[model samples]
Target chain A: MEFLSERARQKLKSALLILSFFVLWEVACLVFKVSEIVLPRPTVILGALWQFFPGIRPHLIQTLYTTLVGFALGVGIGVVIGAVIGVSRVAYDTAYPLLVGFSSIPKVAVVPIFVLWFGAGTTPAILTSMVICIFPIVVNVATGLATTEPELEDVLKALGAKKLDILWNVSLPRAMPYFFASLKVAITLAFVGTVLSETVASNRGIGNLMMIASSNFNVPLVFAGLFLLAGLGVALYVIFSLIERRVAGWAMRKQDFAMG
Target chain B: MMAAKPDTFVPALPPSAPERARPLISLEGAGITYGRGANAVEALTPTDLDIDKGDFVALVGPSGCGKSTILKLVANLIRASRGHVFVGGREVGAERVGIGMAFQNPTMLPWLRIRDNIMLPLKIVEPFRSEFRAKRKTEFRDRAEALLEVVGLKGFGDKYPWQLSGGMLQRANLCRALIHDPALLLLDEPFGALDQFTREELWAILQQLWMDRKPTVILVTHDLREAAYLATRVCVMSARPGRIVADDAVPFARPRTLDMTFEPEFVALTQRLRGLIVDARTGKV
Candidate 1:
């Protein structure tokens, strides 16, 4: 304990808290003689997950591949569109209302239309995820660009920097922290979108597997699917957070001093 | 070590003969009025001015006197509502280039290291711009580092802008402004945000940079002493519908020291400029 740093101690405390929560849940289920169908214990879920690991592998890979492809496309399109709106008042004024209106429509409502257009498979799932994640990135990147310091712009403008030059040198770099922030939000939403589409229309994926498990009254297996999805979402979120720290470390440093 | 008392009133020197024939910058009845119709606010009154090459001119007055407006007009950051502005014998237009500018805020990009910040202008302005990437690691880096050393910021080039103090950032801002060696430099109260001691120290650093480069400078400031100390000519502007009411020549010699600021003649000159501003603010001009 004495050798542990403050960060290490905090992490240890968090792990202990999570472990205790599972222990309490397991104990309560046993003490109450709760039916496995009503609420599967964490141990039962873990056991089911281990037993079904070989069979679930393909579905897990399918979900991951769909999410990554959709997310990559979303980021590429979002950055370009965001840059356009950010740099031009006309684009922002014209596109902002439409974007707001579109994003407001619950993304789950859009999955059926994607299924109709692209058919019930990986295509619908990928399209759903791609559309779901784009809005946050666009809004964040636009806000970042629009907020560039007028003083900085004047400095470059006086040096005869063209509009393109200003965009490259100032606006894009300034928007990075915002872009990374959006990525964190977008990644989680991407998982939600993929799962929702897979449940509604796809034959393969964690969502479809969970649907089948629940229909069969295999409560532990259903819970296992949920845990798997949650684990994957957290892992992606943490990976994006790490990337954000590396790319926008200056902004993070500012935040650290601000919080202190 | 007291210098002899000098004449209290020295006539403004007409831009010497040949220089007068082709002044570097001339403003003829140029004015600016923001908005349109009834909502319009006249920011600057149409007026005339001429600055010769290598001259150091300061525009000083109360706030909203359009001293900063004049700098913007010359820099072509904003268009004039009336009349014309000529730079290098050509009418100022959209394509004006090769000018250096610094603001009171010390607007360094936080993401860029100090050396890169200083070299930013070179990556845009021509001659250097055409070859900036090729020389970025070698020639440009050396130029930025050399300027850092000159401003007493040696060995701090690798640090980010946020890591430096306010005064150090201002010094870097100055370095950025002078990095390209532009023929014209516009400073809009570049030291206005600093404390008294830091401000004084910057005045020396700025003066050294100005003396060494001798760029035609147009500095907008509220500090009358700063105007008197730095500029070869100090222009006092009227409040509101701003116009230059007086253009007085400073009689100080080149390479002026901080101690010179305490001399009776220097004090008298600042006092006279201060009076002009006070009178202008009260509409007594």
Candidate 2:
């Protein structure tokens, strides 16, 4: 109800921006008489989106399932490997060079290899996402775990804590803020990785649908796909941010106080 | 140097009677060096100490004088370069237990609730560990609550560490250390962060905790009065490559209150330790 409320203002501004964009696009099309195949107006895009909402069922499900599989597998593997590497000096030392190299090589370059290994189906897409979505968690958690302060460690030790006990208590809790810091980045990458991998190889997902729409010069469908991807990204990021806010309450409070 | 007084450097420890219960911890010919040869800095050189059961010992010296190193040696948190550390008459070869420690900064786990932070040791240390989540666990909670009560933090159990003031956090920090009822409580200047009044207030709380718990305490501090008031014996060290210079015992007795700070005996002993630190400062020790 309040005029200056942040959420209301934000929503109002976004609605205005979208409205103006559509208006400009319509005017540009009218003035130039741009072919609909080349550049569709907002109304056409909306119509395509309406059609898409119904026809996208089977493909959307397939794409989403494959994407999520890749994302989850990547996260699972990344966390376990990262924790081991993060905690153990010898393990980290042995793995560091290889991980560094793996991190450097662009994940996009591996699509063909994954395709050859797993075939041009959901497997390849999932594999690509798995490869692409893991690094941030590994890097972030490892960094967080390694750099816990010595004095805290000593206190835990003096309290007669077993090594595992200290790890569970001080090191793990201390690493939480850093974990969430990286998780926010990691989750978004997972989503993107899935979508991109699907785009390259998927048959039923939004990505494949986009490719189909683009090649056929169905501009509204392409715009529809783009808009959906953007929405997904925003939604996922907002969800992760909420989780971060809860898990890292202390860090947020200090930041908020410091900002004020 | 003659042993100054009975109540000064030794507490009335119930377990210390009859059997010569070997000192809670001992440092024998301890030496620590950083680096080697021409570049080596010998941080501590052949230091010896017998911190008695329930005696509050203060290791005070100028910066870089290895005051912290002495506490480390006693805790067995680090190895001595050339000597041995003993706790409860055995080599610190993994059987040593019941050592609670605190540092200058309040190192509470930022994510955990204050109750969880205090209950950490119970969840870690043996006897308490296996039975923690099992047996009612009310005992551990009561123990934490009692310690918090003693530290004047009765209702702050659920609040996170960040939500508390520095003084309150440090009190909770010390409580977490003492929760396991360790025989040797090692405090490295626990009140160094609080204001003057707050620091003095914490000293009284610390004294009462030491009095009630009767743990062998090694408090590393730069404050001479803190050393005098809280410690049974104040061990002064020389600068840089440090060794004990003045090992003076206080003259005051138990049931010591804030009023004792105004007494002549307290003043004289405070002045005496002050002179020893100055003696250490001038290389006069």
Candidate 3:
């Protein structure tokens, strides 16, 4: 095994940071002397985490599938539609006002409507996830595409480029930095959309389990579900970030690494 | 003599040969007015002008004096309130495939490598693009490399626009403009942003490139010395709502050097142009 000096040091530093947070948390729990019913101690939460993972393995897989599929569809449609509207003036004028109007309406307010229309299943969750996740991509990508430098546009025109070539080569690549930023927002929204869908409409996914645990005051499990949801959100975020890293390798050039 | 208005710009440049060769491009009775009614300001009055095949011309004038407007009119970026334009001997219309352009700012696409950025037009503009992926990719690349080498960007194909120095970007910008070898080359102060050293370097580079390519060129700039250095003919204009006041030929030798500006003949031409510009500023022309 090749053990690099800097990598080992970074690993040690991160581990220490995480350990420090846990220690601080444990100390605060003991000093407050709170009952297990609210804000369990570090050991209690860690134990609960171990038990919950294997027990809800099937539900975990189900939630993962719905979240991924919905995210894919939302991003796919958002990018294509956003790019279309971004490049065309009439389309931008006609559709942009409508999109902005729709986006202003709260996404969660439509959760029940989706359940009524699609019923309580993966469909509702996916549809809800897509709704929550798609708008930011559209807005961000469109904004990026619309705001491309006019001089560059002139260059393309002089070169004899058609609309499609301009969009594909000039406008689209320029929009990607914006697109990746929106993807981060989309990842968090995907989790919120999926969980909200499950909480409101589904009976089999993590959302339903949380609701059942809370209504019965199975306090530990409910806290566990909350923790689990946060973890799932982090996992999804990490995945989106990885995809961003893999595909948009060019963004590394923008790494001016701000200190403040 | 038939009554002719000085305010009018002719629709076609007269045939230089006076017989056989029609101008590759010409403007007849061209006028541009911005706004309407009380607010209207005429940027350029109706004026006649012609550009023969392979002519290298410059438009020199005060700021916002419609030197650029002339370029926009020719590029069909905008239209004149009156007059007809003919490019390649045909009336300017929707099927124009014969124009290349460069701007004051070196506006290369930032995301694309320099080579690909230059290749963008070929990806879209046809004849080339339609046959791009198949028969002409190698040919297009070789052409791009050759053009790059001409502009001193031979080894920078894979680098992005951001990585290039300003002079390099401008050189790349100039090459990109002429890559397709259009019948007309419209440059709007293409070196207006560079430092003195870089600008003079590009000046010679542009002169040589023009010599090599020999397209009909109309460059717009506020730099009188620049116009004197590179152009075969210099057209001066009046202030905003601009109009051409003088269109004087340089009558200097070919392949001119920057050192030529110190010579008596070049100094005389510059002084004469400066006097006209002073007259223009005073509304005395």
Candidate 4:
């Protein structure tokens, strides 16, 4: 009960901090008589958010769909590639430098290529998100498999475990915590990729809506779009975090006891 | 590699054991060298040793004396650089199907519950591997629970290894090694990490387990008192490029206790082995 109350107190404190920031912004804008085009007041942004709620829903859904689809593809391709590279030294040595080189190319720069190939719209946004998100999964999964303790492998081999059996029984379970950690980081990158592509060439998403609002000089509507994007990102991040806690709880629990 | 003459390198057979207790494992000038050419380093010198069926043999020596190399050779974890290793009266071939092993560290998979970890070998070896799915619902789980019970960890099978103390984890590790009913068990300092009291307790547990199953066991340890207390015979090895310098039988009777370690006969045996190890380490013998 004491721990529960302490957690509640921390949540309340964080809520107040956010509330104070908005209040301070509202007061500063009102005092300076700042132009709405230059810097909209918190009250104006809230009013615009209410007015644009129905208009924004479809755009929000479109952005969510593209990010999720791209994330799924990235995870599938990343796991297969990571497992192959991790199990064989030759594959790792040959492919790791190439992967690093590919990831280093700014994903936003690839958006134009994707648009040319897929002819603009949802396809480009999804492809751009996959390009941005795949690296973390590949890197984390490979690291997990490569770092299997030598003693554990020796024990399994002594028991007549083949390479495939070891992978299925030991390596895959060991990779879960790493895979879930990458999902948290990659989900954010997936959103970034979608928004960047939507701003460049897509016509019906939150990123496009923000661009249209800015061009029309409706800064309040642009702020509303930014707020909605943040909410979506936070919501998706929370979902992934919950799944991580469920699947990889063993890794976290193992650290509590000293080795003795 | 130079050839070691067969007549000079043969290990002595156990005179006290029954005549039918034939040698189950033998190393005929078996040795290991790491790397190649100029960088090559001999880890174990060409040496011969024999262990009889149902015998508990312990290898004791100074650190880095290649005691573990012998255990690895038997398990086929690493191939010999020269000569031959035979187990169960045949050359130990490509697949080492019925061998069990445990290391100094418990080495339990942190992701698995103790029950699943103990059942892991069954998912790999022999007829059990093929029947694992059907037996998982009945026999496989029963065997795991029974082994856990033998190690005094009856209800803890549902827990992960990390939840246990180091001694408990080591006990669980022993269960995992023995779960598959392997023909031979290799232990590389299995109790080397425990506190003195825990070590003694586990010694009793291991002694009882060995008495019950009677599997051919080769234990590699740095603890001389441990070697004297548990083994039917103890072999002391020389430093680096290691070979056995002393092979002495422990003439004590079965169902031994911690009390036996305090006996004058046991003390004399430990002191003798200790002096031999000291000499071996200092190159005196």
lDDT tens per residue, model 3, B1-285:
112333343344465645657777778888898899999888888878888889999998778788888887777666778986656555554435467788888878765678877876677666776777974458888889999998788899978777789899999988878777877899988998889999999999999998988988999887788999999999998877678899999888889999998899899888888888888887786
lDDT score for candidate 2 against the true structure: 0.79
lDDT scores in order:
0.88, 0.79, 0.79, 0.88
Let me know the TM-score candidate 1 reaches against the reference structure.
0.92
Poorest 10 consecutive residues by lDDT, candidate 4 chain A:
A251-260
- Residue pairs in clash, model 4: none
Fraction of native Cα contacts reproduced by each candidate:
0.83, 0.86, 0.63, 0.94
CAPRI category for model 2: medium
Best by TM-score: 1
Interface RMSD, candidates in the order listed? 0.8, 1.4, 2.3, 0.9
lDDT of 2 by residue, A78-104 (tens): 778888988999989987788888978
lDDT of 2 by residue, B52-139 (tens): 7788999888788898988887776778888766666656634456888999998888777788888887887888888899742588
lDDT of 4: 0.88
DockQ of 3: 0.51
User: How much is the lDDT of residue B256 in candidate 4?
Assistant: 88
Residue B215, model 3: lDDT of: 87
DockQ-wise, the better of 2 and 3 is 2
Cα lDDT, model 4, residue B76: 77
